[model samples]
Each structure stands twice: as C-alpha cells, then as structure tokens.
Target: MLRNGQILFLCALALLTLGVLMVTSAGMQIDQASAEQPILVDGGLSPIAIMSGRTGMYAALAIGVMGAMAFVPQRLVERAIKPRPGRFYLMLGVGAAALLGLLLLVYLPGIAREKNFSSRWIEIPAPVFGTLSIQPSEIVKWSMLGLLAWCAVSAGDRLRLFWRGLVPMLIVLGLVCAVIMKEDLGTAVLIGAVGVIVLLAAGAKVWHIGVLAPAATPKPVVDRLNAAINKLLALPDVKTKLDRIGVVPMPETPAEFNKRIQE
Candidate 1:
C-alpha cells in the first residue's frame, strides 16, 4: 500500500504535469499573416521542459519551487510553531513581517508592476530568469496559508478562545484579505474563504462568527425533496441503485494483479 504522503505526492506530480501540458499547449498559434505558413507548425511543447522558452521557464520554475518545498528541513518547519524552552519565538513574527513586507512591495516605487488594471506584481530583473515578475498577493495567499496552519497548531488550547486565538487569526486574515482585495478581489475572497475554513478546522466555533442553525425545512419542501431523491433512486442509471445494496465489480485490478502474481 502506498503511504498517504506518497499518494499525495503522486497526485500532485500528476496535476503539475497536466497543468504544464495545458499551459504550454495554450501557447500554440498559427501564422495567420502568412499564406504559406502551416497551422500549429511545431505542434506544441512537452509537459516538462527546462528553461527552453516562456512555458519552459514556467515548467522549470514550478518544478524548482515544488522541489524546494519538498526538501525543506523538517526541523525548520517544527521550530516555526514549536521551540525549545528559553528559545525566542521569532519565526512567527518573522513570517508575518515577511508576508506583510511582500504585500507592501506592490506599492513600492520603481518596483510596482501593474497587471489587469491593478498593481499586484513586482518585476525584478533576475539573472537567468530574465525579468521575474513576482505577484506579492499570490505569494501572500499561499505563504500565509502555511502561516495560519502554524498559528493554529501553536495556539493549541488557546486556539479555541475567542479573543486570544480566533480573534488574532481573524485580524490577520482581515488584514491580508483587505490588502489583497485592493489588488485582486477574487484572490482576496479566496484567501478569506480558505482562511475561515482553516480556522474552523482548528476548532473555531461557527457561533464565533455569529452563525446560527438553519431553520427547519417546511414539511411540503421536505416531502418534495424526499420524493425527488426517491425518483432519482428509481432511475435506470447504475448509480441509481446506490440507495439499495449493490456491488460494483472492478475486475481490471484483480486481473492485472493475478497476472503479475502468476508471472
């Protein structure tokens, strides 16, 4: 059996491969200006390439970033939320400050680069990567997610408290969202939604945000819903019989396994 971590890694690698393929394929174009030129002359780039072109650079960068993350020191991550006695809890502030500073970079003089009618990127002239346009909002969105997880873990018993745990998280979440919302409303809302989910997972009560139980459905509406469900179950589709006990035999796996075992 594959370990959970290995399974997750395999799934992520597959997704990354698919994304690179799609992105590179999107760059395909025809020479409409030339009558002699063929359509999609070179076909397209492969799923993985190393700094061959724009898409190649993106693929390489993606692999490099993922590899860097995968190889991060376990102790460094542990020390972020847990430290020995008498040691300073510096990672929390450093992390928050770093994220905040990155967010603020979008407004910096000569560094700010605008896209989609908003100043959300900072263009840095990288050596091999040409002009590397860094979107601070994107960085902040991903980085702060891990930051939120660390905060939630470190909070422990305090994570359940309104003022000490949830409030602080909400404040940080609000601040990040408020910043990103100015540049990109969609990303801000996404960050807010995911942040709220993390907080909730960390044991923040739904009532902490003033949520109440939904009112009971009307009897007529409930009856209609039940009827619809029953009708769905009565359909001729294979999934329809899920309401009743049924076996779905997937024989391919067993066949392959048996063949391998015999071989």
Candidate 2:
C-alpha cells in the first residue's frame, strides 16, 4: 500500500494530468477553426494548440521535479544543511544575488513587460519561436523561503536570540518584501506572512510577528483596497449576480461593511 506522502503525490499528479487534458480539449476547437483558415494553415499549429502543448510539457517537468525532490536521498539534503567554512555564506550570497537580480529586472525598461497595467513580469527567450513571460516574484518567493531556512539552520542556537538571530532574518525579509512591494503588493504581503510564520516555527518570539500587524494595512492601502473593491462590485456581471442573490451590492461605507460582517 502507498504511504500518505505517496498517495498525496499521486493525487496531485492526477489533478495535473486532468488540467492538461482540459486545456488540450479546450484548444481543439481553436485548432479546428485554424484548420479552416487558409492564411493560418501555413502556420502549422494554432496558438492555442501550441500553448496547450507547452502546458502539458511543463506539467510533465513539474511532476519529474516533484518526484526527484520526494525520492532523493535524505542524507544528500542533510549534507547541504551541514555547516562548512564559507559554504553557507556562498549559498546565501548566490541566492540573494539571483533573487535581487530577477527583482531588479522587472523594473528595467525594455526588459520588463507590463500586462493589465502591472509591470511584474520579465520576458526570457524561449528555446523555440516566442518569448516566455515569467513572474520573477513567484521564483523569488521560493528562493526567499529556502534562504530563510538556510539562515536559520546556519544560525544554529543563535536563532533563539533576538539580536543575533531574529534581527538579521527580519532585515533580510524586510529588504525582499520592500523590493517586491513596488510592483506586486499582494505577493510581497504573502511572502512576508510566510517568512514570519517560518521564523516563528524556528523559535522566534510571537511579538516579533505581531508588531507587523499595523504595517500590514496602512490607511492609504485600505482606502485603495476599498476603492478597488467598490469598482469591482460596480461591474456589470457582479451587479447582476448581486441582484439575483438579493443581497445588497457592495460599495458600502466602513460602518455598513462592519455591520454586515458582524451580522
């Protein structure tokens, strides 16, 4: 019988397989439509077909990666965490520099690509045909998590100390979130929350995480959030849904929202 982890992995792989099938099925109509167009006939495959193929290929790659990480020798991973002269520093330096470079690339003109009024992706040349747009923030989030774990492990018992341990970790976290927040506030907040949780799990004090609450939602941010929510609620589809449900539509004042939530 498969163990819990094995079962979970199988379930995730199944879901990924299902997603690939669905994408390909949806693309088939586009492929058929392209088949009828004489101009597009010379282009080989339709754009949707190409995208679906790429999605399946990526899903396969992801499964392989997950399997490798899951079944790799534990001792090998342990060896990475084991302390050696300049080893930890070298790892930290490389990870930090790569993350910062990717983040900075999102701000450079002609390199950063904007979509939906947000400049948060960078285009990298693909092996074939077109460029692939990637959100650096996604990669940085995982790197930051691994970096935090490395720092905590490297710190050893020093991680228990407020100055020697928590301060430096907080500093690193602050810098990462600061850079990411300029274009992706949502991702920055998510990274910050995860970093704090990891720190707490690694033995940092509770108040250290609590102190971040005030800064989590500043007045201007709350106002902007409210405005955005109001705008979204005013959209045609959203208004129709609200009307069908017979619930009062949004754009409520603070007091009205609070009252509604309480009830």
- In TM-score terms, which candidate is top? 1
Candidate 2 lDDT over 12-93, as tens digits, reads 9999977877776555433345555634333445546545476766787789899889978889988866764345455556
Clashes of each: 0, 0
Model 2 poorest ten-residue lDDT run: 206-215
lDDT of 1 at 250: 24
Instruction: Give lDDT per model, in order.
Output: 0.66, 0.71
Q: List the candidate 2 regions with Cα displacement exceeding 4 Å.
A: 1-9, 21-52, 66-74, 81-93, 209-263
Error of 1 at 105 (Å): 1.0
Per-residue lDDT, model 2, residue 139, is: 92
Error of model 2, residue 101, in angstroms: 1.5
Best by lDDT: 2
lDDT of 1 by residue, 160-229 (tens): 7777667767777778877887877667756766777787787887556421122475656655655554
